[model samples]
Target: MKIVELSMVLKIIPKVLQIFLNFCLVLLSLILSFLLIKELTMFLKIFMTDGSSDYKMFIANILIFFLYFEFITMIVKYFKEEYHFPLRYFIYIGITAMIRLIIVEHDHPIDTLIYSLVILILIIGYFIMNITPLERPNRQK
Candidate 1:
């Protein structure tokens, strides 16, 4: 039998690059989130009066929250070995996003219903994937 030397193991550069990219991307997203929140808060000040449609500001807050939450999830998942996506969180984001899209788009009701159906299918897919059972524990075949 031939022996495999530990020193002969080749380094994987692409994974290293991917790690670096995920880190930088997260930082960029966080910075952008902060800047957007600052700008939106300032912009909403004009609508402080009664009878103003604060819906824009409310939707903005929901979007900003989801953006930052996704950034935080990415940061946490960067070091995890297993698949790192939080399925429920993504589904929740998708639902909120579709709602926001409907609110902002004013599209035909039929189109909006179709879009919502797509989002529902996506959430169901995620749930199915998350609930799938593992075949084995602690041993590789």
Candidate 2:
């Protein structure tokens, strides 16, 4: 084989290994995240005998579910070669985190409103940055 092909083969060996590891991580993250949601449900069922706090428990469970979904989405993106470190995912996580904060701090109306708006602005900026197509490829020049 040409040296170039041999070198490419050598380079690809590590990448294939990484793909296996990436798949394991994705599976693990999905399993663990769902397990957390399940565990939270079990906890709610056991502790909610006192129905006075039912609304609080419901909100808490929903927040847990949302956070788990965000984490699984991030892990799936890690398998991408071009976006192994996805800043957009981080922004998404941040926005979700802010929403969680708002839900938890609803009593503080001003702070809750501020954080909600911040999350809105951040999501808008994320779309603006990511949705625009890349500059033309060299062949188009």
Candidate 3:
């Protein structure tokens, strides 16, 4: 009887953890949505108030906004695709992040070149993923 009960508890553990993780993800999505909105508002405010004098800041904020948007979309895709995140979305995020890093922190020429290389690698990976056939391990054919 004790062994049977232990087996049941072990089975329940994964379900509980899955539920907890889903709840956390939902909360994160809400937070990111709010942040995305805030970034939009900030971008607009900067545009209207200061004109294009702060072009660097303006561009940086735009990148941040897109980053938030991509994360939210990735989370939504996660729930839609049966909790499986596609590799392409991650590669897209990586490329965007590297570009943003290059734009925002170009003080060092070597660092910017390295970030460009990273972006190039991510793009190549994305192309490779696209060319490969989709393999859904958990799908029932």
TM per prediction:
0.63, 0.59, 0.91
Sliding window of 10 residues with minimal summed lDDT for model 1: 1-10
Alpha carbon deviation, residue 124, candidate 1 (Å): 1.7
Of 1 and 3, the candidate ranking higher by TM-score: 3
lDDT of 2 by residue, 1-141 (tens): 699999999999999998888778878897968777796776668576665566665676677677777777777777655538677878877887887787777888899889989998999989897898869568854
* lDDT of each residue in 1-141, candidate 3, tens digit only: 999999999999999999999999999999999999999999889988944697888898999998999999999999999988878888888988898898889999999999999998898888888898777679686
Whole-model Cα lDDT per candidate?
Answer: 0.67, 0.78, 0.91
Best candidate, lDDT? 3
Model 1 Cα lDDT, one tens digit per residue, 98-140: 7667666655888788878978897788778778885747766
- Model 1 residue 25 CA deviation in Å: 3.0
* Model 2: residue 134 alpha-carbon error in angstroms: 3.4
List runs of model 2 lying over 4 Å from the truth. Answer: 1-31, 34-40, 43-53, 80-83, 135-141
